[model samples]
Target: MSRIQLALNVDDLDSAVQFYSTLFQADPAKRKPGYANFAITDPPLKLVLIENPGHGGTLNHLGVEVESSPQVHAEIARLSQAGLFTEEQIATTCCFATQDKVWVTAPDAEPWEVYTVLSDSETFGTAPILATGEAVPDDEAIAVCCGAAENATAPGAPCCG
Candidate 1:
């Protein structure tokens, strides 16, 4: 099965966690210092919240969480065939998971990813390493995830905002 993933940047992690917990009637499936994720089955959604003090209370990114790595790769190929530019991160970490992801930008500049999680990681994985084992620099990795690099938007501007 696949799920729609909605990632949001919030000012307060604890508060957002509390509110979403009540709203969804389920506690987060994963929680860390600056992030929380809920694997909600009732509504078939993957909700993620990250605390970013500089955020504008807008969306961080959107994604499709598929069941397998092949699904991710297939989506990547499909997007490329449709002429959308994509950036692939294989075995890289993000949002506390080791994931294989392909990121693309919507027409409205919203960042979207097709990803499959391989394993859990201890930290919020921001520094995504390339398939060739080259690590993307900190600032550049952050820009890619935060919509600055792909969306052609100012740094810190919301991807969907």
Candidate 2:
């Protein structure tokens, strides 16, 4: 199964969780220090809340959560074939989980990813590969989940993932 994932930045985690839970009539599937997610059944939505102070009520990133890594690989190929730049992150950790994913940016610069979670993690994020898709040293990676790749047209770029 697959579900669209929405990651939102909030100033307060507790407040956002409370409101979303009340609105959806469901609790978070996972809760961490500053992160929470809901696996909504009716609408099949993966709503994620990120405690990013001063960026309340704004989108953090967007994604589609698939069932496995093969699905992620398929998206990478499909997006690339369609002439959209693609950045593939395999076995990367983000949002307190290990994931296999591919990223792309919309015409308006909105970041989107097709991903599958492999397991939970204790870390919040890892250094995404550089704009060249090279696995540079951690010190050299750009620190944005949205992508440093937007500046370039060619495939392969950086992201906060």
Candidate 3:
């Protein structure tokens, strides 16, 4: 199934986890040192919480989590055909999982990604694609996931983890 993903930055992991668990009446699908994700069925939402202290309550990025890599590739085609700019990431690790995703920018500068998780990973990852649309180096994989401003020059075009 496909669901909308909303990634948020919170100040505290424990408190946010408790509140979201209560609000959604669901346990987190995955929880790590500074991260947590809830797969909520009723609303079909993927809520991701990243503990980024000063950015609390702020949105990290938006996305549509799909069922497979083909779905992600399909989106890349659809967006490209429509003339919307797209950055593609294949077999890249992010949010502690391997994923295939395509990124796009909204009119107001919000970053949105269409992705599918392929497998789990041991570490959190950054968008393999950098702001210049170049793949990030192996040593730089520890950067932020879905950084709000992925490209300092382009502003809203974000790199995803």
Candidate 1 regions off by >4 Å? 54-56, 126-137, 144-161
How high is the CA lDDT of each candidate model? 0.76, 0.75, 0.76
Per-residue lDDT tens digits for candidate 1, residues 20-105, read: 99999999999888778999998999998877766737777888899999998998899999998988878866667788888888
Superposed on all Cα atoms, model 2 deviates from the true structure by an RMSD in Å of 5.2
Candidate 2 vs candidate 3: the lDDT winner is 3
- What total of clashing residue pairs does each candidate reach? 0, 2, 0
Models 1 onward score TM values of 0.83, 0.82, 0.83
Q: What is the C-alpha lDDT profile of model 2 across 1-161, one tens digit per residue?
A: 89998878778989999999999999999998777899999899999887767668777678899999988998898889999988777887767788888888888878888999999888766766557987755533324333453432222222232
Query: Listing every candidate in turn, what is its Cα RMSD in Å to the true structure after a full C-alpha superposition?
Result: 3.7, 5.2, 4.6
In candidate 2, position 53 carries an lDDT of 74
Off by over 4 Å in 2: 128-146, 149-161
The C-alpha local distance difference test score for the whole of candidate 2 amounts to 0.75
> Between prediction 1 and prediction 2, which has the larger lDDT?
1
Could you give the candidate ranking by lDDT, starting with the highest? 3, 1, 2
